[model samples]
Target: MSTAAEVSQNNNVGPVMRQGELAQAVVEAAEIDNPDKIIKVEDKVAYLRIQTSDEMILKRQTIEEMLGRPFSMSEIEIELASFAGRIDTQVEYIRFYHAKHL
Candidate 1:
């Protein structure tokens, strides 16, 4: 399989993850990519996303953690299908999705 760098080839080496999933992954990446990120855990679910200017960064594993399972083929398709129409650049998009489960 292609490595993270090969996938995010245009970027500075990273996995090929979705914008929404990337938002969640970067937040879950580690404590260092933080201070700007703040997760809001409500009910039985946890919402996460990044607070940086670059929304294209993908760190796939974070999404799996949030999802609790590898996303299904249809699930991935659905998220990407609606990806562009979502215009909220400033707010936490991934968290918005996560919050729904709460």
Candidate 2:
């Protein structure tokens, strides 16, 4: 088991989203949008924790593509239960990141 201190030592950042289609789409989007980063997803039954080291980005376009429908960036709030690190949201993309490396 990992301790909180051990977990916090890494620069992991992303969202904890309600487990459903939207969360699945976001995970797929994060993977596609951040090809350089290793996206991680933790299945918590009730919610899904999607994250990456340092930074994780999800593009609206990628989500739309994953969902096979139009998606609004603001719509993410409906499924966002919590998040790690600082978040930067825009019309085109949402970024979860640490301000600096430890």
Report, for every candidate in turn, its global Cα lDDT versus the true structure: 0.33, 0.91
Among all windows of 10 consecutive residues in model 2, the one with the lowest summed lDDT is 3-12
Candidate 2: lDDT of 23? Answer: 97
For candidate 1, report its TM-score. 0.27
TM, every model = 0.27, 0.93
Could you give candidate 2's per-residue lDDT for residues 1-102 as a string of tens digits? 998878767788999999999999998888888899888899999999998988888888899999999899989999999999999999999998899998
* lDDT tens readout by residue for model 1, 1-102: 898867543211122224554334444553232335443212212322222322332223444566567643234334332221122222122311211111
Please report how far candidate 1 places residue 62 from its true position, in Å. 1.1
Which ten residues in a row are the worst by lDDT in model 1?
A: 93-102
What's the true lDDT of residue 97 in model 1?
A: 20
Identify the candidate with maximal lDDT. Answer: 2
- RMSD per candidate (Å) reads 15.7, 1.3
